[model samples]
Target chain A: MASGRPIQLFRNMTAKIAAIPMILTALVIFVGGTAWTVVYSFTNSKLLPRANFVGLDQYERLWNTNRWIVSIENLLIYGICMLVLSFIIGFVLAALMDQKIRFENTFRTIILYPFALSFIVTGLIWQWLLNPDFGVQNVVRGLGWVSFEFDPLNNSSIVIYGVLIAGLWQGTGLVMVLMLAGLRGIDQEIWKAARVDGIPMWKTYLYIVVPMLRPVFITSIVIIASGIVRVYDLVVAQTAGGPGISSEVPAKYVYDYMFQGQNLGQGFAASTMMLLAVAIVIIPWAYLEFGSRNRG
Target chain B: MANPATISTAVAGADTLPLDGPQGPRPRPRLSRRNIFIYGTMLVVAVYYLLPLYVMIVTSLKGMPEIRLGNIFSPPMEITFEPWVKAWAEACTGLNCDGLSRGFWNSVKITVPSVFLSIAVASVNGYALSNWKFKGADIFFTILIFGAFIPYQVMLYPIVIILREIGLYGSLGGLVIVHVIFGMPIVTLLFRNYFASLPEELFKAARVDGAGFWQIYFQIMLPMSLPIFVVAMIIQVTGIWNDFLFGVVYTKPDTYPMTVQLNNIVNSVQGVKEYNVNMAATILTGLVPLVIYFVSGKLFVRGIAAGAVKG
Candidate 1:
């Protein structure tokens, strides 16, 4: 086991060489780049990232900006609605699929196919479907229900909900798949014992199955939460943050400021907030997961 | 084996519980109430999920005049392939009227190298981490895993600066590098876990035969790791193909990948909206990933599971 110092330095040299890219990406890009952005957020960088320090001014302006406020509001509404609805819908679909039903693969394929498509495609498809003139409203009116109204895209008050519809259509399949896996992992004996004890299926699921699938639920939430924060392309494709910027999200706000609006300071500040939002979701989850494992 | 023991125990546990219903097999109907509820709910949800794809195909096949007068739900009276051709050849994004073909090829150019390079780099890194445990490797690996959760926006500009300084900004090469950088966390995790799960005896045996790092990787590990390589490919192909943000941020107009180009084409405001052409373009942009998904089948789910369930 005793080796010379020079030999130790040269040992596994191929590995160290191969890992250079990972090292650089982890150290320089992920760690260093994040630090650079957080630092630049404090400066009044316009069009270009400069060393000019203006402490907290960018964040103050970011808060005061109506567009940023709207983006944050839309993100919250979209995030909460997406989280709750996706879990409910995903769990329900998964449970139904688990009912020893026929054509389970076919139903699953139909539901999960949308997850294969990009957000852009999902957005465009929904935008056309929600077009008031030729879409759902027109069809209903032609069917003799002339007073029906179902347009959400053009209405500023409900545009974010419109985006939410497309978001759910594209994403809930992933949640369903994850939940289905979790359900399958449960022991069949649990269900049989419940049935023998005169417990209804619903009660058994509520009491026994769901709590056992807690890890899967947490994983689904983490995946969905990160996705909800990065809700950019769908907005850009469907509404283009339209109806007077009412559907703008934080990701879109950052993009417009950095690339289009030429306000790097604001972009950095907004994105820094995005990073913070992800941390708030991730840090505790990571601790509970990895922390408990190490201790046990 | 353990299976029979567990099964017998489970059967005994079920028998110990008090049964309220008849013990023997009761009269069971094919269309029972529970069956009706489950199948009916599943059918309704399936229709809702299928509606958009159905509408896309129907709308893409219709003429503009038909699209204007007809309901989106109604079948097209006249099927026309004109929209498909127009979407592929004549759809414009800014001054370039050459359509989605340009963007499609650009995506290919971007995807192929990005997938190969990232897999090569990550597979080796994973092998090294799992087998050749050097000093500080776990720390870097931990940082890499944590990096996946950091929002990409936080690193966007500094990457731009880095790319600019390295003279790869606004080029396809630059976008490929970006994909590799972001893809590192998940793919490395995939490979690392996979290699770790492989029997340690094989690796140690090769080492006893005086096999070095690269030699053991190429001679022993590579042959055994084909399925995981496919999983990584599936992840990268769909991911790089579906990407919009990186493509938009990293490349110029001529070099913009399909997603960005498709967005510009569909959302452009200069002319009257061509719904048929726009739908066709949308489908075109999505076709690559969709095909990969259908073809891969269960592997697609495995890819998502691998990417999602991080420890």
Candidate 2:
């Protein structure tokens, strides 16, 4: 035991001290805060945290409320469409860019520039662009298509799609960049082998290369899916869940309830639902992604 | 990795064999049908991406009457910078008509300190985790990384409560902390991966010289990890600048960041809509990150790839 000078508690003292914020956040805020929100969702608190248990009242109310139901439905539609379309569009773009095209740098910079702008800007731009009288509709009408109906912001049933246009415009570029990275990561020898075999490029890409890019696909899905889950700001900035709350999303619902309405229990329940939805998507994927990490 | 010269050489090889002799005089048109298709599609998509920006620029430059009259696709018939001037100096948010400059300065205040502090924490934490090997460091790191997935809405109220309890809820400083907390997982993941990917010999050599943890971090790790720090700064500066939810939720009305202020100014329901001013404000709000994006170029791509691949 006397072999050592001393085993002080502060041996890596700087590290332990430096890590206090991360440790506190990981523990107190992330874990503890999420658990607290879940627990408080069961309470009847209004405007402040309280301990009065209210059982499933909040949950039932949340489900029964047309706004909340609409939020979930919109989330589903947006989530599915954004996920599928972004992947397809992104992959196709990446494939095209991978075709040894000229002006690759220019195309990449132009396409990816939107990823730089905030959602607020994207929403505002799209909002003006979609304005019924003076936006794309009016411009097209002036160009002699007076019967054109390109207005999506003003339509309730299709307002989510309106938000979708902005979201896709803002998002797909990042997906393409990620996919391009994936495509570039692939070995060219595979392409050479396919060429030597007289296999068509499309067939080679579909059969051999697509399967090879599974990890990249998974990574893209995770990024896009998470963005879909947190699809509040786009909706807020674009539509403000307008046309009678038609494009309302759960994140917006939770925010509105908690802050504007001061309905804490309702907001908590809605957010708990949001967390649950993310968990549903993330858990299985995380299992496959990280679960494989351990074994690999 | 194939340079232009190599690609042309390969094409020249293919070209000489089939259509003409190896010394054929004429070169085929570079715009083959396939090249046309690829470039055409990319050009269209690029235009689709550039449309909003073009509209923003010209729309902001035109007079309000001209904006109302002219098509968004057309360049301004007569350009004016009045909107830009007004948006910067006199655009009203409630009783304050001092324009987005306040919000701009506020965002600068928030973003600079937050970026520096977040990088500082992440670099140290990453160095410690990679080299020091504390007993339970990885466990906490795992939790923190996974914690990034938790919806910000859930933690919003709790953070408000915490900050309020500490008497910093509505302050800009409070928002800085909020950004750091949210930015931690990605930034840390970034710095950690970069640090971990460094040659093990460097760390070992430093330790062999009796360099303690702080000494090594400040002396060896920080200097060597400059690129990663820039990536982190790129990520945080754009991210914090673009953040609307936290800006709205955490800051007071006047103290709101540019994104929040722009939203209020443009989307305000009271006054008659100033289309040109609104466009100018939107562009101004977007300019910080846009400038950074254009300036940073490939580093921005590397930054995102780092976050994505590692996350």
Cα lDDT tens digits, model 2, A234-253, are 88889999889799999999
Off by over 4 Å in 2: A1-10, B1-29
Model 2, B1-311: lDDT tens per residue? 34445766777787645544454234557877877787788888887888888888989999988877779889998889999999999999999999999999999999999998888888777877888776688999998998888899989988989999999999999999999899999998887888889999998998889988888888898889899889999999999999999999988987899999999999899898999999999999999999999999999999998988857
Cα-based lDDT for every prediction? 0.93, 0.90
CAPRI-wise, candidate 1 is medium
- For candidate 2, give the lDDT: 0.90
Against the hidden true structure, what lDDT does model 1 obtain? 0.93
In the range B1-311, model 1's lDDT, one tens digit per residue, is 15456765676677888767555434469898888888889889999999999999999999999998889988899899999999999999999999999999999999999999999999999988998878899999999999998989999999999999999999999999999999999999999999999999998899899988888999899999999999999999999999999999999999999999999999998999999999999999999999999999889999998888763
Docking class of 2: medium
Question: Residue A13 error for model 2, in Å?
Answer: 3.0
- Model 1: per-residue Cα lDDT over A14-34, one tens digit each: 889989999999999999999
Q: What residue runs in model 1 are displaced by over 4 Å at the alpha carbon?
A: A1-6, B1-24
